[model samples]
Target: MIEVRAPEPGDLETIGREAREEWVRDRFRTGVDFSPLMDKPNTHVALIDGQPVAAGGFIDRGNGNAIAWSVLGRVDERHFVGLVRAFRKYMKATPYRWIEAHCIATFHQSHRWVKCLGFVPVNGERCFTPDGREFRKYVFRNHNGS
Candidate 1:
Protein backbone atom coordinates (compact mmCIF):
# COMPACT_ATOMS: atom_id res chain seq x y z
CA MET A 1 0.00 0.00 0.00
CA ILE A 2 1.10 3.55 -0.72
CA GLU A 3 0.60 6.45 1.65
CA VAL A 4 1.23 10.12 1.00
CA ARG A 5 2.07 12.33 3.98
CA ALA A 6 4.02 15.33 5.16
CA PRO A 7 7.74 15.14 4.66
CA GLU A 8 9.95 14.21 7.59
CA PRO A 9 13.53 15.19 8.35
CA GLY A 10 16.18 13.17 6.49
CA ASP A 11 13.63 11.49 4.25
CA LEU A 12 15.39 12.83 1.18
CA GLU A 13 18.19 10.35 1.69
CA THR A 14 15.74 7.47 1.63
CA ILE A 15 14.24 8.70 -1.62
CA GLY A 16 17.69 9.15 -3.08
CA ARG A 17 18.68 5.65 -2.12
CA GLU A 18 15.62 4.16 -3.79
CA ALA A 19 16.19 6.14 -6.96
CA ARG A 20 18.38 4.47 -9.58
CA GLU A 21 17.12 5.93 -12.81
CA GLU A 22 19.56 7.90 -14.91
CA TRP A 23 17.01 10.54 -15.76
CA VAL A 24 16.05 10.91 -12.11
CA ARG A 25 19.64 11.66 -11.23
CA ASP A 26 19.92 14.15 -14.04
CA ARG A 27 16.68 15.81 -13.00
CA PHE A 28 18.35 17.44 -9.99
CA ARG A 29 20.20 20.69 -10.21
CA THR A 30 23.79 20.06 -11.11
CA GLY A 31 26.31 20.45 -8.27
CA VAL A 32 23.65 21.70 -5.85
CA ASP A 33 23.62 20.21 -2.34
CA PHE A 34 20.12 18.90 -1.66
CA SER A 35 20.43 18.25 2.08
CA PRO A 36 18.70 21.54 2.92
CA LEU A 37 15.52 20.48 1.15
CA MET A 38 14.64 17.99 3.84
CA ASP A 39 12.85 20.70 5.76
CA LYS A 40 11.54 22.67 2.80
CA PRO A 41 8.00 23.90 3.31
CA ASN A 42 5.04 22.47 1.34
CA THR A 43 6.95 19.30 0.54
CA HIS A 44 5.56 15.77 0.85
CA VAL A 45 6.69 12.16 0.80
CA ALA A 46 5.22 8.98 -0.57
CA LEU A 47 5.80 5.83 1.42
CA ILE A 48 5.09 2.24 0.63
CA ASP A 49 5.20 -0.30 3.43
CA GLY A 50 6.75 2.30 5.72
CA GLN A 51 9.64 3.13 3.41
CA PRO A 52 9.97 6.45 1.68
CA VAL A 53 9.74 6.05 -2.08
CA ALA A 54 9.42 9.59 -3.43
CA ALA A 55 9.79 13.17 -2.20
CA GLY A 56 9.38 16.72 -3.53
CA GLY A 57 8.15 20.25 -2.86
CA PHE A 58 6.78 23.48 -4.30
CA ILE A 59 8.65 26.77 -4.35
CA ASP A 60 6.80 30.09 -4.23
CA ARG A 61 8.16 32.42 -6.91
CA GLY A 62 6.46 35.66 -5.95
CA ASN A 63 3.71 37.44 -7.91
CA GLY A 64 1.36 34.52 -7.32
CA ASN A 65 3.41 32.07 -9.36
CA ALA A 66 5.20 29.02 -8.04
CA ILE A 67 7.06 25.96 -9.29
CA ALA A 68 6.62 22.33 -8.30
CA TRP A 69 9.19 19.55 -8.41
CA SER A 70 9.55 15.93 -7.32
CA VAL A 71 11.92 12.99 -7.51
CA LEU A 72 10.79 9.40 -7.52
CA GLY A 73 12.28 6.18 -6.21
CA ARG A 74 10.04 3.81 -8.07
CA VAL A 75 7.35 3.96 -10.72
CA ASP A 76 3.99 2.93 -9.33
CA GLU A 77 0.71 4.18 -10.73
CA ARG A 78 -1.12 4.40 -7.42
CA HIS A 79 1.60 6.47 -5.81
CA PHE A 80 2.07 8.79 -8.79
CA VAL A 81 -1.67 9.39 -9.10
CA GLY A 82 -1.88 10.21 -5.41
CA LEU A 83 0.88 12.78 -5.72
CA VAL A 84 -0.79 14.46 -8.70
CA ARG A 85 -4.08 14.69 -6.80
CA ALA A 86 -2.31 16.22 -3.82
CA PHE A 87 -0.70 18.80 -6.11
CA ARG A 88 -4.12 19.72 -7.48
CA LYS A 89 -5.46 20.07 -3.96
CA TYR A 90 -2.61 22.37 -3.00
CA MET A 91 -3.17 24.54 -6.06
CA LYS A 92 -6.81 24.91 -5.18
CA ALA A 93 -6.05 25.99 -1.62
CA THR A 94 -3.14 28.35 -2.21
CA PRO A 95 -3.40 31.87 -3.57
CA TYR A 96 -0.70 31.22 -6.14
CA ARG A 97 -2.05 32.17 -9.57
CA TRP A 98 -0.06 29.46 -11.34
CA ILE A 99 2.41 26.66 -10.78
CA GLU A 100 5.07 25.58 -13.25
CA ALA A 101 6.61 22.16 -13.72
CA HIS A 102 9.61 21.25 -15.83
CA CYS A 103 10.88 17.93 -17.06
CA ILE A 104 13.28 16.67 -19.66
CA ALA A 105 11.62 16.41 -23.06
CA THR A 106 12.92 12.87 -23.36
CA PHE A 107 10.91 11.81 -20.34
CA HIS A 108 7.76 10.88 -22.21
CA GLN A 109 5.80 9.61 -19.21
CA SER A 110 6.17 12.84 -17.28
CA HIS A 111 5.46 14.97 -20.34
CA ARG A 112 2.25 13.04 -20.83
CA TRP A 113 1.36 13.35 -17.17
CA VAL A 114 1.70 17.16 -16.92
CA LYS A 115 -0.37 17.41 -20.08
CA CYS A 116 -3.10 15.07 -18.81
CA LEU A 117 -3.35 17.09 -15.60
CA GLY A 118 -3.93 20.41 -17.43
CA PHE A 119 -0.43 21.90 -17.44
CA VAL A 120 -0.31 24.09 -20.53
CA PRO A 121 2.74 24.47 -22.67
CA VAL A 122 4.31 27.92 -22.51
CA ASN A 123 5.58 29.09 -25.92
CA GLY A 124 7.33 25.72 -26.23
CA GLU A 125 10.42 27.10 -24.58
CA ARG A 126 13.23 24.67 -23.82
CA CYS A 127 15.46 25.26 -20.82
CA PHE A 128 18.85 23.98 -19.88
CA THR A 129 20.29 23.17 -16.48
CA PRO A 130 23.85 23.80 -15.43
CA ASP A 131 24.65 20.33 -16.67
CA GLY A 132 23.59 21.35 -20.19
CA ARG A 133 20.64 19.00 -20.58
CA GLU A 134 17.57 20.40 -22.29
CA PHE A 135 14.15 20.48 -20.62
CA ARG A 136 10.57 21.48 -21.31
CA LYS A 137 8.29 23.49 -19.02
CA TYR A 138 4.58 23.29 -18.27
CA VAL A 139 2.27 25.63 -16.38
CA PHE A 140 -0.87 24.92 -14.39
CA ARG A 141 -3.27 27.65 -13.34
CA ASN A 142 -4.74 27.70 -9.86
CA HIS A 143 -8.44 27.07 -10.03
CA ASN A 144 -10.93 29.12 -8.05
CA GLY A 145 -12.40 27.20 -5.14
CA SER A 146 -15.83 25.95 -6.16
Candidate 2:
Protein backbone atom coordinates (compact mmCIF):
# COMPACT_ATOMS: atom_id res chain seq x y z
CA MET A 1 0.00 0.00 0.00
CA ILE A 2 1.10 3.55 -0.61
CA GLU A 3 1.13 5.90 2.36
CA VAL A 4 1.96 9.56 2.90
CA ARG A 5 3.44 10.78 6.15
CA ALA A 6 5.54 13.54 7.66
CA PRO A 7 9.22 13.12 6.97
CA GLU A 8 11.46 11.85 9.75
CA PRO A 9 15.05 12.81 10.45
CA GLY A 10 16.20 9.33 9.46
CA ASP A 11 14.76 9.88 5.99
CA LEU A 12 16.96 12.90 5.29
CA GLU A 13 19.93 10.95 4.00
CA THR A 14 17.74 8.86 1.75
CA ILE A 15 15.79 11.84 0.49
CA GLY A 16 18.96 13.77 -0.25
CA ARG A 17 20.40 10.84 -2.20
CA GLU A 18 17.22 10.43 -4.20
CA ALA A 19 16.99 14.12 -4.99
CA ARG A 20 20.61 14.17 -6.09
CA GLU A 21 20.12 11.20 -8.37
CA GLU A 22 17.03 12.78 -9.83
CA TRP A 23 18.84 16.02 -10.49
CA VAL A 24 21.68 14.25 -12.25
CA ARG A 25 19.38 12.17 -14.39
CA ASP A 26 17.36 15.24 -15.22
CA ARG A 27 20.55 17.03 -16.34
CA PHE A 28 20.74 19.48 -13.47
CA ARG A 29 23.60 20.63 -11.26
CA THR A 30 25.00 18.56 -8.42
CA GLY A 31 24.24 21.27 -5.88
CA VAL A 32 20.44 20.95 -6.15
CA ASP A 33 19.95 20.08 -2.54
CA PHE A 34 16.43 19.54 -1.24
CA SER A 35 17.32 19.26 2.43
CA PRO A 36 16.91 22.92 3.24
CA LEU A 37 13.68 23.13 1.28
CA MET A 38 12.19 20.05 2.95
CA ASP A 39 13.10 21.30 6.40
CA LYS A 40 9.70 22.94 6.67
CA PRO A 41 7.40 21.63 9.36
CA ASN A 42 4.90 20.17 6.90
CA THR A 43 7.25 18.31 4.61
CA HIS A 44 6.07 14.82 3.70
CA VAL A 45 7.00 11.70 1.86
CA ALA A 46 5.00 9.18 -0.12
CA LEU A 47 5.94 5.65 0.76
CA ILE A 48 5.06 2.42 -0.95
CA ASP A 49 5.56 -0.62 1.25
CA GLY A 50 7.86 1.50 3.40
CA GLN A 51 9.96 2.71 0.49
CA PRO A 52 9.86 6.42 -0.14
CA VAL A 53 8.66 7.09 -3.69
CA ALA A 54 8.03 10.82 -3.57
CA ALA A 55 8.66 13.90 -1.47
CA GLY A 56 6.83 17.20 -1.17
CA GLY A 57 6.23 20.13 1.14
CA PHE A 58 4.22 23.24 1.75
CA ILE A 59 6.00 26.58 2.11
CA ASP A 60 3.98 29.28 3.77
CA ARG A 61 4.03 32.57 1.85
CA GLY A 62 2.63 34.25 4.96
CA ASN A 63 -0.42 35.59 3.17
CA GLY A 64 -2.88 32.87 4.04
CA ASN A 65 -1.42 30.63 1.36
CA ALA A 66 1.37 28.19 0.64
CA ILE A 67 3.32 26.97 -2.34
CA ALA A 68 3.86 23.24 -2.71
CA TRP A 69 6.15 21.09 -4.77
CA SER A 70 6.25 17.33 -5.12
CA VAL A 71 9.06 15.42 -6.76
CA LEU A 72 7.69 12.04 -7.74
CA GLY A 73 9.29 9.13 -9.40
CA ARG A 74 7.57 6.98 -11.98
CA VAL A 75 4.68 5.48 -10.01
CA ASP A 76 1.24 4.10 -10.55
CA GLU A 77 -1.88 6.24 -10.56
CA ARG A 78 -3.04 4.68 -7.31
CA HIS A 79 -0.07 6.09 -5.45
CA PHE A 80 -0.45 9.47 -7.11
CA VAL A 81 -4.09 9.67 -6.10
CA GLY A 82 -3.27 8.62 -2.59
CA LEU A 83 -0.62 11.32 -2.28
CA VAL A 84 -3.05 13.97 -3.46
CA ARG A 85 -5.72 12.83 -1.03
CA ALA A 86 -3.23 12.89 1.82
CA PHE A 87 -2.04 16.35 0.86
CA ARG A 88 -5.60 17.63 0.84
CA LYS A 89 -6.19 16.33 4.33
CA TYR A 90 -2.99 17.91 5.55
CA MET A 91 -3.71 21.31 4.04
CA LYS A 92 -7.31 21.42 5.23
CA ALA A 93 -6.07 21.07 8.77
CA THR A 94 -3.54 23.86 8.34
CA PRO A 95 -3.82 27.65 8.14
CA TYR A 96 -3.28 27.82 4.40
CA ARG A 97 -6.20 29.14 2.42
CA TRP A 98 -4.62 28.53 -0.98
CA ILE A 99 -2.12 26.17 -2.58
CA GLU A 100 -0.05 26.48 -5.72
CA ALA A 101 2.60 24.63 -7.71
CA HIS A 102 4.93 25.43 -10.57
CA CYS A 103 5.28 22.57 -13.03
CA ILE A 104 7.57 22.16 -15.95
CA ALA A 105 5.82 22.38 -19.29
CA THR A 106 7.81 19.45 -20.61
CA PHE A 107 6.12 17.21 -18.10
CA HIS A 108 2.92 16.68 -20.03
CA GLN A 109 1.76 13.87 -17.80
CA SER A 110 2.12 16.07 -14.74
CA HIS A 111 0.18 18.83 -16.44
CA ARG A 112 -2.72 16.52 -17.07
CA TRP A 113 -2.60 15.03 -13.62
CA VAL A 114 -2.56 18.41 -11.94
CA LYS A 115 -5.49 19.51 -14.05
CA CYS A 116 -7.48 16.43 -13.14
CA LEU A 117 -6.75 17.22 -9.51
CA GLY A 118 -8.45 20.63 -9.99
CA PHE A 119 -5.32 22.73 -10.41
CA VAL A 120 -5.95 25.28 -13.11
CA PRO A 121 -3.20 27.20 -14.80
CA VAL A 122 -3.10 30.63 -13.26
CA ASN A 123 -0.04 31.95 -15.08
CA GLY A 124 3.07 31.12 -17.05
CA GLU A 125 6.62 32.34 -16.77
CA ARG A 126 9.97 31.72 -18.33
CA CYS A 127 12.51 29.70 -16.37
CA PHE A 128 16.13 29.20 -17.24
CA THR A 129 18.45 26.39 -16.36
CA PRO A 130 21.96 26.82 -15.06
CA ASP A 131 23.20 26.65 -18.64
CA GLY A 132 20.74 29.32 -19.71
CA ARG A 133 18.39 26.96 -21.52
CA GLU A 134 14.88 28.33 -21.26
CA PHE A 135 11.72 26.44 -20.29
CA ARG A 136 8.11 27.31 -19.75
CA LYS A 137 6.81 27.36 -16.21
CA TYR A 138 3.17 26.58 -15.62
CA VAL A 139 1.68 27.79 -12.37
CA PHE A 140 -1.29 25.85 -11.09
CA ARG A 141 -3.50 26.74 -8.17
CA ASN A 142 -6.14 24.87 -6.22
CA HIS A 143 -8.64 26.27 -3.77
CA ASN A 144 -11.83 25.12 -2.00
CA GLY A 145 -9.90 22.47 -0.09
CA SER A 146 -8.36 20.61 -3.01
TM-score of each: 0.77, 0.69
Off by over 4 Å in 2: 9-31, 123-146
Compared with the true structure, all predictions reach lDDT values of 0.71, 0.62
| Residue 105 displacement (Å), model 2 | 1.8
* Residue 127 C-alpha lDDT in model 2: 68
Rate residue 123 of model 2 by lDDT: 50
lDDT of 1 by residue, 23-73 (tens): 556535254467566565667787877888877667878888878777777
Model 2 Cα lDDT, one tens digit per residue, 31-130: 5556776788878877877877667777888877787766655556667677677655665565666777656656566576556455667654666657
- For model 1, the superposed segments whose C-alpha errors exceed 4 Å read 23-32
Identify the candidate with maximal TM-score.
Answer: 1
Which pairs clash (backbone N, Cα, C closer than 3 Å) in model 1? none
- Which pairs clash inside model 2? none
